[model samples]
Target chain A: MGGDVIDFYFDFASPYAYLAAGRVDGLSQRVGRPVRWRPILLGAVFKISGGQPNLNKPLQGDYLRLDVPRCARLWEIPLHQPLPSPFPSLAASRAFYWLDQVGGEHSPAALARAVFQAHWAEGRDMALPENVLDVAASLGLERDAVEAGIAQSQVKDRLRAETEAAIARGVFGAPFFFIGHEPFWGADRMDQMEDWLQRGGW
Target chain B: MGGDVIDFYFDFASPYAYLAAGRVDGLSQRVGRPVRWRPILLGAVFKISGGQPNLNKPLQGDYLRLDVPRCARLWEIPLHQPLPSPFPSLAASRAFYWLDQVGGEHSPAALARAVFQAHWAEGRDMALPENVLDVAASLGLERDAVEAGIAQSQVKDRLRAETEAAIARGVFGAPFFFIGHEPFWGADRMDQMEDWLQRGGW
Candidate 1:
């Protein structure tokens, strides 16, 4: 069996990504592949791809408003509604890279999960740096270290580079996965991804 | 079981809709629901919804080029690649409405399937009215009647009105389905649609 790590690209601001975050780990375990969680800024990716968020579109925005919650209920994931206005995903994304770089008692994945839950499940506004820090602190991460790490030029640059790299790699949307060289986009595509992984491509 | 016909909104221009066309009948049979096929022009829908075709976008276009064939393989559907440049879906679409109006020995659904197969399975250029008529003729549909029906102002107006109605009903994409009041979009959402039909929503 090929043991290539599945690269999961996501933005915390995306509710679909939040829904996908809950279940990707289980898929990884089932397929016996380690997941590399890569948080990216969709805003940057969109600027290049000339794409807009579903919430910004007309009919699609309406459909997303309905679909997200229904999917949450069906998937049995707890999700709070009406996310913070101008949902701030930047701070959380930066914090993720910082946590990843720090590599301490808490894995970056845990912080990512906690941040997704705090923002999506508990309706916390991730726009505030303190809110992101608060979620990190809840995970026993050093509050000062996290704040410092996120502010560091290296961490900021890491996020910028990663987002650019994601765009370069043709990732235009959240909850995108790369099982080997094959790319699957959207939370709904997980089933197809699993099938591809198991069948080794048809 | 409450008998409600599933409204399937599609555009012949969309490859995803073509893929959905092959399976929707089977789904309808399995769920004990009749399907009302409604073909709308996506070009009009996109104008109102502020949407662009996946093929027009950057990263998404590349991904779709790869994903379409992969999905065809996974679904075991025979699909010909490199679709006709500027795929003439309008002719086939108009012809479909014409066929529906002049219902005789052949069902409109049969014409839809044949048109999809000719365009997608055989890589026939649907831009030509002759090609669309030829497909209809192969299906035992009267050629001259179909040509005359498509030319009628009433048939043109019917297609226009249907496209307008689709937008009013919030159909922004191809292969959109309505199970009662619940709306599901995309060819990939078939499993969810089936589950909703069988489980009567969660």
Candidate 2:
């Protein structure tokens, strides 16, 4: 990453993350910051935060089932409408911290994009190891390096550590970003984030 | 209203309208369009469209109370935040259309901006005659002409007709704009509406 960097710590289990992956880099670049992609498991983060899935909230399940895709269509983004959308993000999310450790300065952005596309776009099985490797190889990266990263105990620890770091930073959810200690906790603030960055995060 | 105009039909009662009002003009300038300000009653549009207010539903009331202002702050706009939002809006709705009749010819934009500021910015009582007059004065418009226009049966009839026309155009809510029937609802789309003026609403 070049310029003033704002680390965009994210997870593949989120549709918001998919949208952010496409726009975050461009947003940062336009606003004169190079956004650093930091992939971390939200499951671990949730465990720490004690946050409940929004769909499980009363009446929200219907909104997610019906309203969310309507909102996506209005914004002109493609949607698969994940069947079990509060996705079991463990394997795919762990894969990222895993890749970062062993993949030797890997293209975090590319890998993040591939897995986001896998879960949100292709609607593939995230729990499957074959699917994870398929996502890596498709990105023209070595698959064994990713698999090797996952098998290591340190990778698991790093993911946990990163999640704990996010919680300590006061991040309440996935797609959380920061400017110094200012926590903006939604995907909707993307433009404002760019505006703040353009002003050198003043 | 110049160029290939996109009339942003909107209501002050709607929170989304406030968000759109604050930024749509600037956004349109960025997107290269002239956002025509078309003030209309969302309640009337809902009446015609059979659309239910989300507030009537239990869970949505909380979401509205929370999420709407979050969008306002996220977008950096002012909000009134009146509890129960004063259910009946007919008088204010009529007044906007009435003002448009007097101020409609060339400077509808000024008149529309004042109304948005009054309702969303200052949280003034829109039903008060003095408040509306002050809004007119702030726009550097003659208060007498606005007062005179309010007494006209034609203006009132025309406002009712405008509501009917909005319904005919499939407008389901306030701050809904049609870029040649490509509905961009909310005052926030005003920039999009403005751009339609530049790009030809097709």
Candidate closest to the true structure, highest TM-score: 1
Top DockQ hit: 1
Judged by DockQ cut-offs, is candidate 2 incorrect, acceptable, medium or high? incorrect
The parts of candidate 1 lying over 4 Å away from their true place are A1-3, A82-86, B1-3, B82-86
What are the DockQ scores of the candidates, in order? 0.61, 0.07
- The TM-score that candidate 2 achieves is 0.56
lDDT of each: 0.84, 0.63
User: TM-score of chain B only, all predictions?
Assistant: 0.95, 0.78
* Superposition-based RMSD of candidate 2 using all C-alpha atoms, in angstroms: 8.1
Candidate 1 per-residue lDDT over residues B83-158, each given as its tens digit: 5333747778888888888777778888898988888888888888999999989988788978888888998899
Relative to the unseen true structure, what is the C-alpha lDDT of residue B86 in candidate 2, on a scale of 0 to 100?
Answer: 30
Tens digits of per-residue lDDT for model 2, A16-82: 6666676676677676666667776776766765554556644334434543443344445565756
lDDT of 1 by residue, A51-92 (tens): 778888767888887788777777778988664333758788
* lDDT (C-alpha) at residue B128 in model 1: 89
